[model samples]
Target chain A: MTTEPPPDAHAAFSAVALTAIDDVYRFARSLTRDEVDAEDVVQETYLRAFRSWHTFETGTDVRRWLFTIARNVFLRSREKGKREVTLDDDGAEIVDAALAREAWSRGGLDTILERADLGPAISTALAELPEPYRAVVVLVDLEDQSYESTAEVLEVPIGTVRSRLFRGRKLLQEKLMQHAIDSGLIPQPTAPVRSTE
Target chain B: MNHGHGSDDRTGAAAMDCAGAMDRLFDFLDGELGPETEVRIRQHLEKCGHCFDEAGFERRFLAAVQAARAAEVCPATLRARVRDALRHAGWTEAAGS
Candidate 1:
């Protein structure tokens, strides 16, 4: 006769997997950028995860595994084609820290937090980022995943994760700076100085 | 990766310049830098008011993003749906055996 797992085995699986439910859903929403699609992806991720539970290593990171699966499912769907924007390198140079500090002290960061309403502005900015950059930011900055773990989740080299994260944060900063100016908190300064030294 | 710092000795030299410090700002903040490199950057920030403010702004910006993300809670209905699906799958597996 075939042996069966004890009834509590399923319960144990649910307990551990359910702890990551919110994380998975939030990641799904960030990737899909649409409520319906995000919900569908989360559902599909859970089902696939359940079916493949036997393959999961006992001590490994379950969260990253779920994210990998979720991202794969999203990519397989037709909506993937619509979300492939790449980072624009023409404006990706690092800003001079001294000038950037001057601008920020002159109401840049404060204005972004106060007038633009931090939560919504950040959410919108994150959503507007190109997909590759957005994924890195979401996985690293927002989710607090390590660069190594993020590399694994995105299936890219650690160097790519670092570069994407740097560029992504830079882009987000630019957006917030613009928001600060548009909110009348600060006047736009001359273009950021390109340091040749 | 060497920014032309000729000697391995970082101390007693002039503090890191703006470019050098800024290049490692994120890595420094993320705790990814080696202890010696981190000390060099920290020493630079101590002397460079401008770089300090720049680092401060980025730190706060990252904190704000984390706060915003923490505020997001998963919907109850979705949690329930996932729970039910797992339950059904479990039953199905048991029956098939």
Candidate 2:
């Protein structure tokens, strides 16, 4: 016969996952640039994750799945429509095309990335990579996920993922190289004459 | 795989689109390329200045991105905020009450 276990004084919750919590916040931050929005997203995501922890399968990549859910919540909030349309991104079918027009007309990305230090320039360049490209870059380049896994999370085909990643990287490289030129990281073209020698 | 510097014919040789090049580049950088394609790209680069620059630039750029990722640790205050939120959400026992 087994003795009835007395009520444990320990907290019912698992340990306060400091790192995991920070990751949720950061993932939220990456998804939404606004700090307040990010905080709200993080809070909601954690509440959901906590409530469903028992259902989360063992040996699965918890962080990746968590990111998918958080991204969904963020998108749902965006799809709910803003009270007043901000001058930034609104992904509705027609609105987004208009937004694209405005973004393109501003030549928002035409300025060559000035190579100051890798930190600031790279950050700015990364930010400049346009909507979905930016997300793919953050997930694959920054977050270090495999292509298939990233596609699964982003809900795009593997080909789409590859295309975006390649496009983003090519653009980013050009920006950084331009920065390098301006910042004197690389020597300027020696005399404008094309060297055929 | 042709390393003929003066050759203008890329038709019969292995040429890939931007998408394919990109996929191969990432996999190659990650050391996932087969020996054949790897050698082909290497020989291609030796003759094709543009592709050579593209490959070189991406290789260096990925390293920089890796370094950037290394430094992206979240703020300590961010963590504390999460903890506080968890407490408020009644996610912890003592804190839940």
Specify the highest-TM-score model's number: 1
- lDDT string, candidate 2, B1-97, tens digits: 2223222233345755454554466666654455556556667666677666667656666766755664455566765666576556554444433
Give the runs in model 2 whose Cα sits over 4 Å from its true position. Answer: A1-18, A21-26, A80-117, A178-197, B1-23, B30-53, B93-97
- Against the hidden true structure, what lDDT does model 1 obtain? 0.71
- Mind giving the per-residue lDDT tens digits that candidate 2 earns over A1-197? 12221223114223433335545665666668667888777766766666555555656767786777777778777884343223222323323333334323222222322222576567656655555666777777777776777789878886677766765665565455445556655555443311110
Error of 2 at A165 (Å): 0.6
True contacts kept of each: 0.40, 0.32
Q: DockQ for each candidate? A: 0.30, 0.22
- State in Å the error of residue A107, model 2: 23
